[model samples]
Target: MKWKVVVMLGAALTLFGCSKPDAEPTESELSNHQSQQVVIVHGLGRSAWSMQTMSDLISKQGYQVCVVDYPTLRQSIDNTLGESASAISNCLSQFEEADFVHTNQSKTHFVGHSLGGLVIRSYLANHPDFVSSKEMGEVVFLGTPNHGSDVADYFVNNGLLSLLGETATSLTTDPNSFPNSLPQPNYEFGVIAGTQSYPVFSGMFDNSNDGLVSVESTKLEGMKDFVEVDIKHDKLRRDPYVTRLILSFISTGTFDAS
Candidate 1:
């Protein structure tokens, strides 16, 4: 009788231990459960404020957003890369603050527009320490000139290209420089292209372009997904459709144009 009672007690204990539910997630875990930091870099001649709308939208979905501001026209690619890296470090520091304040330590995601995309690519390629293959979640490019821009050539002859310094030539005439700066598609990345052309610059492109870069040129080698928006080049950054596509890509590794 004593032995049977002991066996029954042991069996009851085992069932209780197995049936106990997991504790509820802490405040920090709840906040960072589906949370991630998004760093937005603007294109040439554009300030960090250019990405404000996108940042706000993402923030509404429980993400911390940082829009990096740098002197786009005053420096070469090397100098710009240095400044951009510093900005990225600063954004990470802000995450540390969030950890201290809210007790959440989440990873970061990078999203760049036009020349800014190139800057992120160059920085990631050159400075592997800042972002490791495992640490990086996703990278999104908006109207990035992966294959250089013909408009840059026109701007160079017209003297407007001086504002962009070495960046203009690096993307246009000096193909070897900027092309080599980017890392191969070893990680997950998405590219968004603009198909609508502004009337004034329609004659500039060979065929279909956003007045600056061609749709074909935006098709990079390592990109996991590619999308085309009917909006013009300048307006592509602000399109709601583009924003939805970007959000979809970030959440899932794939994006559909429709």
Candidate 2:
């Protein structure tokens, strides 16, 4: 099997594989392989479709993949966390219930993009035990607002933008908002930020940003590793470099960083 590598160069992210794939293994051949599952949650205003590409590539690596969907545009993170947790649980439960794969050391990884990252954080905060029970692995946040999004505050202040509803307003990095209330990640995790910004919302950020989320905003207190890619916020999930970086981290527990 070939293991991929994620490397950080000046101002950009690059991905290169370290080895070549050998012959494909049969079911019997993989029977002893450590089973793993990856759960992908899409960001605000998006659906599972947005994460399908990442899911497919992960599945090609022989891990089971689950793409979770929710009403991110209408429901607040508070309301969506439980549902996302349930969906992820259901996905992991299939392997256990069917006995198709060994559960003794089964591992589960979580991936979220943008607001989807916050949803995962909220889920963990609310259901701390799920980590140990599921043999939890590392988490990867792509362009997520760990602190909060200034664009969110910008939109909330504009009366017309409020029509987008709670989902839109809830992301503000207000002193007393949901994002600020959450605890730092207890499990291994890394955040990938986009150095490029969308020209339209670029003015909303006080510092370097990925259109909606500032690089500073994507940072959490105890992140295992951090790196910036030239990709944009919404496109981070699908960007080849970003996706390969995700694969590298989930498999190795680390990605190259400056």
Candidate 3:
């Protein structure tokens, strides 16, 4: 329940930040260097509203930020992927327009949380022409179950994952899933893992989890860098440490181990 509260608070803060007067200008307004846009995607059972904190913080760092939302539990994984791809494509088109109208550049970075991470990776893999590693500056995932989640297994075994349909299986147990489906590790990418465990759902996970995904499972072989922090799943996205790490990676193309 505390995790849910954290998510709600994050949503509220994001809304407040966006609505603030004197909202900062987009990347073009402040930079002569080519503008880099960051597209944020949220997790399952969540909305773009959930990623408000991330969007605000990254935007402050001077990247054009667009937070994407999709119906997580209402669509199949394939359908979700298609929808997510469309959203990303739309964002890219907007970036192209901004380039022609303002910065005159063409590129974007993508960051995703949980299931959103899966969707972004799936899109990049299947549509390499649109979002290749070169065009995609960096890919960052926060607490993604690149290996899959046992909690999802529990839900499916209990017949509770029916509402999620193929999305549940595609995300949870399928070997050909997002991170797994990526062709080659050609993009600059990083992975951040959480170590705090929520007591209410402790029984559902192995040790070293942020209530849902185990820290070890968040590790993927192809990532440029990997980091672990003491934050729960829901709070991890907004945690200053994680946010700072992501910013550092985006700017420097390396994770600050210090």
Candidate 4:
């Protein structure tokens, strides 16, 4: 009963806004002349606003930040992935135009929450050239369901997943779902999972979860590192410690420092 209420409320919130891109800090002014760039993408049914906290934090650390805003409730995942790639490309191109010294040698890192992580994966999978051409750095996945999600499975089984658009359905645990079908990232990456479940609705999952994605669902075989936190799904990107973890992994390819 509690889980059903939560799902219904989530669906209601998702439908409250029009299918438009929200104004976001797409790229921080390149005042610091930082060569490294960090691109962040928000999760399902969320705007780039969802990643604002992390963006600000990373910006403070002197890295240029680009927040990709996609209409999660209105478009297909493939479209979102394409737009995200374009956004990153455009953001990086500016550095070259500015004639930043050694711009070609600068590292590009990615941070994604939930569906956003899959967008990064899909982009890399489809554009194999980016792996070598871009000189990509490490990636960080915050509560990303690399193995799909039970909540999505429940919605699919009840014929209600479509309410959140095709992206939600793609998160289902089905082996053939879009997310599940994507190949594991061949680059350096780390996974951060939240373990605090809603006690009243904990039974919804057989193991620990962050109200939406199970801890196990966030793991990938090639991840350079993995870390768990006592947080809920929505707050994973906002937590200060999680931000530190993200920064640590981005800098060292490990979350141990944070």
Candidate 5:
């Protein structure tokens, strides 16, 4: 019943949310980040609108930001990857058009929330020709289930996951699930997990969680840095302090407060 409530709330928010992206970076802001870009991706069952806050905050930091829109409702991760990659390519093309990529040698960074992180991982793995590690700037994952999620496992066992789509099944805690199958990133990347959880669902996880994903599930081997924020799963993308950490990690390799 609780999981159903969570799902319904997430659905309603995704459908009726009034999120709007902030304006493009100002001339002064662009002067500093002219050769840098950040692409943000939202979580499962959410759209680009869900990431407007992140886009706005990072754009203020001077990086051109793109919030990717993917068909996340009922599609397999593999099925949706091409669309995700295409959106990334289209965003990056702007840098090329402006000569920042060739003349200034721009770097592209990624910021993903929950399922969005996995989308970036899969995109880089499957499309190696797109960008090399040297050209890839830092990546930041906010509450992504890098090791898969038990909440997904629960839904799968009860046969209710089909209602959410194949990606739900792929996100289960099984060793072979999509998130588990992805290789560890070979680029500069950081992980930020949330310690806060909804009281009703906190008991479901053995460790700290963000209501939807356990802190343990958000980790991966060889991450450059890792930190925890006091926020829930749905709020990680908008929390100001977490945004500061994201900016810190992007500007510097460590999330150590500046």
Candidate 6:
């Protein structure tokens, strides 16, 4: 599939009223002009490069950004969440002023795709003050299974496919399972669900799904905002529309409800 995210350097600036963009920052360029920090985490088995375009576009808004990558297939779900916590603190540590009392400290936002979203949620569960103490900002979940996933069950049921990952069972649809058992975000959060179904496993899900995750499963009890886009699960990181919504929530604490 040919996927292209059409975003310009000045797009974020124009929307945030920061300034005109000189040019697109190279993927390796690090900009720390703004006090706000946005950490981006890729989904299971995905690299930080998958989120590079969205991260670059967000940097145009004048915020420091860190794209996190971890070994999802190799680690247990619990271990991956530990990596998520480590990534968030490590990313925040890069900014000298990212502390609870600092002005910019309150704007530390986390954006994650798929299981990465669950990772953030799990992190917040352990350190619930991520928002209460104002140590962090809102979280944006892209195609996360806040409820749980059936695909995981399918894999766990098939011994042949179980070798794919050690964390698949943690994604079972039972609320008692890891995903649903996670505490809801104590801070402001927005969820974006994909409406397109992955035809292969869509039949397993009783509702509209994005192939791997169902739109219904993407919801939670306390997300501040929710929306659906006609995209796939893995594609959320690269979809221009999805990234724009992420920026909107990051800048304004709410997505375009309309």
**Strongest candidate by lDDT:** 5
Better of 2 and 6 by TM-score: 2
Ranking by lDDT, best first? 5, 4, 2, 6, 3, 1
Error of 2 at 185 (Å): 1.4
- Write down the worst ten-residue block by lDDT for model 3: 12-21
Error of 5 at 249 (Å): 0.7
Candidate number that wins on lDDT, 2 or 5: 5
Kindly report which residue pairs in candidate 3 clash with one another.
none
Q: What is the lDDT of candidate 2?
A: 0.71
Query: Which prediction has more favorable lDDT, 1 or 2?
Result: 2
**What TM value does model 5 have?**
0.86
Model 3's TM-score against the true structure: 0.80
Candidate 2 ranges beyond 4 A from true positions: 1-34
Tell me the tens digit of each residue's lDDT in model 5 across 144-171. Answer: 9898876677667777767777876688
Per-candidate TM-score against the hidden true structure = 0.79, 0.83, 0.80, 0.85, 0.86, 0.81
Tens digits of lDDT, candidate 1, 115-214: 7788778767766765663446688988887777766655555555565477545666345758545667556799988888755456668878876777
Tell me which of candidates 2 and 3 scores higher on TM-score: 2
Candidate 2 has a TM-score of 0.83
Candidate 6 residue lDDT tens string, 130-158 = 56765577799988877777776665565
**TM-score of candidate 1 on Cα atoms, chains taken together:** 0.79
Candidate order by TM-score, decreasing, is 5, 4, 2, 6, 3, 1
lDDT for 170 in candidate 6 is 75
Q: lDDT: which is higher, 3 or 4? A: 4
- Provide the lDDT at 70 for model 6: 71
Whole-model lDDT per candidate? 0.68, 0.71, 0.70, 0.76, 0.78, 0.70
What are the per-residue Cα lDDT tens digits for candidate 2 across 65-116? 7788877545655566667778766776775565465656577888989877
- Writing each residue's lDDT as its tens digit, candidate 3 over 1-258 gives 556644533332232110122334455544732477888998877788878887877777677888887775657766777788888889888876784335334458788887777777777777767654445678898888777776666655655456546765555545765456655545678998878876655777756887777787777777888888778788876665677778767766776733
Deviation (Å) of 180 in candidate 1: 5.0
